[model samples]
Target: MKQDTALSERPAVGATPTGPDPERAAPRYTGGQIRNILIGLMLAMLTSMLTNSIVGTALPTIIGELGGQDKLAWVASASLLTMTATTPLWGKLSDIYGRKPLFQVSLVIFIASSVAAGFSTDISWLIGARLLQGVGMGGLVSLPQIILGDVVEPRERGRYSGYLGAVFGVSTVAGPLLGGFLVDSPLGWRWCFFITVPLAVVSFGVIQWLLRMPAHERTANKIDWWGATCIVGSAAAVMLLLSLGGKEFAWNSPVTYLFIVVALVLAVSGVFAERRAEDPIMAPRLFRNPTFVLAGLASLLVGVSMFGVMIYFPQYLQIVKGMSPTASGLMTLPLVVGMLSASISSGMLVSRTGKWKIYPVAGMLLVSAGFGVLSLLQVHSSIALVGTGVGLIGLGLGLSMQILILATQNALDRADMAAGTSAVTFFRNLGGAIGVSAFGAIMTNSFSSGFRSVGAEAIAAGASPDELAVAATGSPAAIHALPDAVRELVLGAFNDAMHHVYVVGAPVALAAFVVVLFLRPTPLRSHT
Candidate 1:
């Protein structure tokens, strides 16, 4: 069996190495190499988030051109679905195959798919491309974290993590603006997708040159291909069910029931497989730690609230509030700023004091409170008030989301760090997928019913009565295009929809807050 003993076996200065020493095989990065790695990883991370946020400012234009405002949630959900479901698989594979190849391959896949997406002429093609791109994106996000885990000890990992948080902060702040500008310019919305190509090409080249790691030598054992297949199948099915339920299919329909049954069976099989597999995608043993379990749950909830909220808020600003793409991006600056502040502050505090639980505990409280406050938003509310609400939510999310991962990694041994971290990340992303689907449905249904009640065209000119009703609630565009009487009706419908969505999110946040209360405090580990 191969073992990594490189870290412990470094010789004294000028010492000679013995023949075939295990230490000789460990990948060592020079300072320049490390810089290359960070830069490469940063580009990859930037690409992972860029597509989603960029779309936020471009959505109204894209939907208007593509004529699929009704399918808007799918744009976000598609990327999240593949990214979330495949995360654990990516982590496990990286462990078996080593990080360099997986990382590079992920970039290539993302780059290729992104280019295809930019040229897509219709919504279906774009959504399909996004799904493919998401598969690559899943690895970019997860593999970098795993690679960081390999090089850094848990305690000092926060500094690198702080770097990652900074990347996320910058991307979230910048993605919408870049996306909006592309949409508004002669380049058009397609450029938003094309923009990732050059960045990815450079990232791949950098990683290939700078990341020279020893081959991962493992005992000959059968890969649990079936288990991985089942897990992916199960995750995809469940996400699809959630995304389509109450929108495309009735919750109680035979198709929905069939999908539900398949999801459950495959998920159960996956659990069993994880326990028995030599290298499980998600090791069952990690959940044995109570801190890991709670932190994972908290992470999941945070993803649901945090990602779910971010995906749609720009649309709310642009469509409902009559803001332009640039103005809408600017309006969201507070949320990004708040996230940056919370992440930096929490990281510094954790590093300085080595006390970490307080942030997530308090953060969750603020999350619930923030969402509760956001629920008060109305069509007539001031932009500053709306930004304040979003910023508060961002602050809570920043404080809690990554901290839970940090706590979970700290609680586990070095060997378990990647799996544990990936698990929490996977579940969180899963929660994001579920939340978007659920809340999207809630908004759609509420808007449709509300619009119908007010009689803003029981049927639209080009759309079905049901479709017209949904569009009325989805954005301000629908309302803006209508006559004054109909516009007022659509506005009322949107208000009801937003209110209901917030109501759902608030309770989920509150429940997460209660869950955090039970988490036992563990000191953050001092190593990578």
Candidate 2:
């Protein structure tokens, strides 16, 4: 029988002589597709994080060699800026253009950029390559959710999302260590970028060979070019202001005010465009759900605290605690372990019980505890204790982050899956940019003040403040070559500077805890 109408909300089917009827479509994901997709996705996620984390350990060397010490944050922030800005656009494009092409395109771009980034002779070139790389990286993170949504029902996704968390945990654990070893063992830092090239090629080949998805029927409609421009402009402008405020200019500077105005105007225009556009870049409707809104806010806070703090931990160990880069990388194992264990365990538990709301409650509490403890860390504190504090933060993060995405997907209609996931990702990235900029600012200011306080004693003893300031960062080879007394003074200044940063970060983390507590309890729906 040929169906004249859609069958049970599925696509229409064939008709027969006896009667015209509709047929229910089989599930989109079958056994082969499921297994292959999982393999491809895991590899993709693993490679992405591994690449990002590996670069963190090598950044100091890369920036120093290129003579753009002031542009260090740009290497990271530029990547993040593009990644955050384009993630939502990728999601929307995936929905319209299909995931396979977009996913493969991202991999190709990332690999190409990785190769180019390695060959760069200066920080500006490196930063530009990194920025280009983010376009690809953004797709890597965004498409997995869309593909999974298309195949798996909401309830089943919790378990699979757990797999992603595990991948993230492992990458976080392994990346810096691997990077540290490579940088220290005569390979130099460029290999950090080169290393991802082969893996990316393999990932792309595997995905092309093994993965297939239903082709999307692209509709004829005007793309929201204006909306996208506004959104991207707004995000970039705001992040730029945040990053440069306390570094390149004073908080009250005219340049800062101009950027602030630009951000506000673009943001306002984006809101207007989204409301009027037939198809929007960032759907405002998602924010209509209070739970989604609250959860998004929470995710933002999590991103801010998590990325801002963890990214600096290696510097702290190398600088204040006087550990080698490799040793500092090793010290992060506890945090990654905690993150992996908690993420995997909590994911399985949520799948089993279909109860997820309470984990965030507990996770946020632990995060607050971790941050509070971390603020107390000094040059004299036990390395093990510092590790324990990071583990606590990881535990909280592992529980709360993925669950929020799961919850948001569950709450939305299946048709809205891409938008919902992108919304969460967007806010989290925004929060991360803000966190890194704000915290980095605090650290810089504190460093200057701390150095001033310690300068007299340091100079009286024969070391200059300039030398001490350079040593406080600890990653530069020049720092390693300094006299022991000068190095000690630098380390002391670094410890004091970090103490100030941590103290401020702790309160922000605590605020996340308070917000999570108020999130309404909701059941984990198996299907949206």
Candidate 3:
């Protein structure tokens, strides 16, 4: 018999089946069906991971063509803001509806946005499409893990989860390359958006044909509209606060203060709404599990370190070490390699040993140590040294990422799995958005402070304030175009500011290191 989408309480693995019903003894997946389903899921997983990194190298070109030189950062920020806010809703909806329709809907939305984005004639148009694209990306990011958990047992999920990590590696490693090449070619930057359309279509077809679950018999399932509204509102407010504050508006400005208050109010209201909700989108019971709480914290802190490195490290190389945009992206490849190898290795080991606690603990320590090493990098640092430092952090991420998911999933019953997974992902992505904004603010403030003396001396010597200001806030090319003496000073300022950013982040990583030690050593269940 097929299981209902709103899953019933089932026997724990190795326990006796309830009531000896003949249909309850059937295996979850037929062998042939399982292969097709996993392949379908892998494609959906690839699209989301690919979307994140694909436009990285092309963003400058995209903004250049679209005439959004001043609004360059919003290109990426828009997608992240929407995706992070919508994730929990996707997970909860899959619980109420079957996974296939929701997943397919997301694929359609993503493809349509990609098509729209490719045709964008202005920055506002492109940002609007990307914001819509995030709605799809949200589902892509969360639902694959939930679907895999639906099909695979906890002990076995590592192998599949490692595949997700592998796609993450491949995507990060290759996305910039593809984007750069396409942007440089006559096909131009728009092709970057066009490329994913075909992939999305294939993913949609594969999912529709191969992915199936029992239609959620929704006789008793009620949508918690108030809880949903408050959670999404609060999340949107928080993301907006992170993305806009200190950049568009002062940190202490009325806009910032208003959002802070709005987010807090909605969040409190959401919590109360959830408590009384018949089918809470966020289960209160999940938080009661120490594993879920610790794992959520670990995911959040890990996200900060992860996004912080991705955002600042490239700029560090380009400005401080005088590498080109392409080279800076390529220089980060070792991080991808380390992450892929470690994630797959840890996954396999966990499956074989059925033990996972030590990986995250050790991984967090490595992350802290890596960030500490990153703090020590100088303008004169060699590429090999940079790779070593970044690779350590990547290895830590590989070890920690999937393990945290597994830890949280193992703690939950069947009904809570989707919500639990979404909650973890939401926090992690939320951390990334916050990390980008906070660290960007740090970089900007530090650069200004570091350049103050340089700027004063230059003005004293008769250079234009406009020129110096452009050098301080401009792109790598602009900075490099300055006079030799001014260029060197600008470079030093960037190097110092980035180094300080890493130092500030090291303690945050250490906090994650400390938190993971408290994770209870729960035994892995090999069967669902």
Tens-place lDDT digits, model 2, residues 60-156: 7787789788888788667777888788788777666666787888898998888889999888899999999888888887777666665566556
How high is the lDDT of residue 157 in model 3? Answer: 77
**Tens digits of per-residue lDDT for model 3 on 160-267?**
687676667667767777888888999998988888788778878877776555435452346899999999899999998898777678898899989989999999
lDDT of 1 by residue, 291-340 (tens): 88998888778878876677667667766788876787788777778778
Best candidate (score: TM-score): 3
The root-mean-square deviation over C-alpha atoms between each candidate and the true structure, in angstroms, is 5.5, 4.8, 3.6
lDDT of 1 at 426: 85
* Per-candidate TM-score against the hidden true structure: 0.86, 0.88, 0.92
Which portions of model 2 miss their true places by more than 4 Å? 1-35, 63-73, 121-124, 185-188, 460-492
Compare candidates 1 and 2 on lDDT and give the better one: 2
TM-score of 3: 0.92
Off by over 4 Å in 1: 1-36, 55-76, 121-128, 456-475, 481-489
